[model samples]
Target: MNTHNLIVGISGASGALYGIRLLEACRDLGVQTHLVISKAGEMTLHHETGLAVSDVRALATKSYKIADIGAAIASGSFRNAGMVIAPCSIRSMSEIATGVTSNLMTRAADVALKERRRLVLMVRESPLHSGHLATMKTLSDLGAIIAPPVPAFYTHPTSLDDMVNHTVGRTLDLLAIENNLAERWDGLKNARTRSQENDGGRD
Candidate 1:
């Protein structure tokens, strides 16, 4: 498979591990990643993951400061496959939706949409107000995929890591990247196997 370059932004939202694991999955798939972390992201990184900014930057192929709008990633000509904002805050999402990027993180996302490239927002808010939902609709209309980091219980995830990996894997699928980070849904694979075995008994 051809190598894909993806831009990842970690906003100030909780569930910062989702962002960290995304970088790790990109490493496993050999997907070159350009990562940007906001000021709130930096704080949440320490608050939630207990990891320093340097440690998180170590996971990406390239890292950009939230203030650096002049970075290559802030332009459409950079030609990345897509951009994902893991645990995207409502403020960042609103910024992207409104085309008013006050920082490099949302600027990159705006570039992706303007370039007709994939832009996935892992919006990490709940009990969203009408304003939030409207912004999401505006983004969706603009071809940005709004994804929340909700776990899939049907996969029978045995641990938090399992849930995280599976959710991230599924999210990356939107970018058309190959990943075996979690078990895929095969329309009840085990149940189908059991049914076939039971039928074979009649033979």
Candidate 2:
């Protein structure tokens, strides 16, 4: 496989763990990640996830200042396979929707959209207002995938890590990276077969 490149951005949202999990998954897959974190993201990471900025930085292959608009990833010709904005905040969503490339995160997203590469925004807010919905629509119309990080209970997640892995795994799927972070429905076939055999014997 060619070296799949991903641009990951973390914004001020409640779920910093999602981003961290995503980074870990990408690293394990040997995908080169260009990471950017907003100022509020740093604050949220500390307050909610109990992760220091240094620790978060350690997860990524490379880290860029959000204000570093001149970064290679900020350009359309950067040749990245895709971009993902994990735990995307409403503010960041609106900026990308309106084509405001103020920072490296938004700029890289804009580049992804323009380049027609996969751009998955894991919007984390809930109880959306008209403005937020409208922004999502706008980005969607521009070929961006607005993936809200809604939990999947059907997976029978046992802990917080399971939930985080499921969402991050789906995000990786969107980026076309193969990962086994979450259990797939097809894997249950063997269990179903065993259950049927036991029921037959009992009958």
Candidate 3:
């Protein structure tokens, strides 16, 4: 396995920034990222961030086309640390869950599952119905981590970037990558103490 390599998938989802932030974080940490973006992903990336497809592709160590099922990351033998589908769309998640992948992104995810590698799907949907929940359950049963990008209030995010960084940092933690992009929770006692200290100074 390539200990320094990580497979990244970006699908058509509302939170395209999550995928971009993940790639930037990995790049900062010196991790080699193998990226694959779906057609809808490209559209969303542009619509949401106004970033060109080539610009996003330049962020990764390597990039693959969605139709390239023969790509190295599509094979279990490719040997990477694991795979992460940031801003994973419901359709993409369903494809992975059912093993009915239509593109290299989902194909790579399926390969990750078959290889017993950590597959983190940052599902980006809200007000999920029973069918969506069932699909998530199925993916979980098959060894995929259904980690929705739920914000952490404890992080006390003052801006959108903070929230994105926190979520991406937590996801990287799941991938076993060390990153200081987000503030770490020390303890409740420490938090209270800090709060009290600030209050004392305020008065």
Please tell me which predicted candidate would have the highest TM-score against the true structure: 3
Pick out the ten consecutive residues of candidate 3 with the lowest summed lDDT: 194-203
Summarize candidate 1's per-residue lDDT along 1-203 as a digit string, tens digits: 32978999999999899999999999888999999999999999999988988999999999999899999998888978899999899999999999999999999999999999999999999889999999999999999999899998876677999999998998888999988876766788685665568679443
**Backbone clash count for every predicted candidate, in the order shown:** 0, 0, 0
- Model 2 misplacement above 4 A: 187-203
Candidate 1 Cα lDDT to native: 0.91
| TM values, all candidates | 0.92, 0.91, 0.95
**lDDT value, residue 164 of candidate 3:** 94
lDDT of model number 3: 0.91
After superposition, candidate 1 runs with Cα above 4 Å error = 189-203
* Residue 124 miss distance in model 2 (angstroms): 1.0
Q: What C-alpha lDDT, on a 0 to 100 scale, does residue 29 get in candidate 2?
A: 90
lDDT of 2 by residue, 1-203 (tens): 22778899999988888898999888899998889999999999899878799898888889999889898898887888899998899988888888866788988998899999999999988799888898888999999999999888766677988898998988888878888986676667775665578679453
Cα lDDT of candidate 2 equals: 0.87
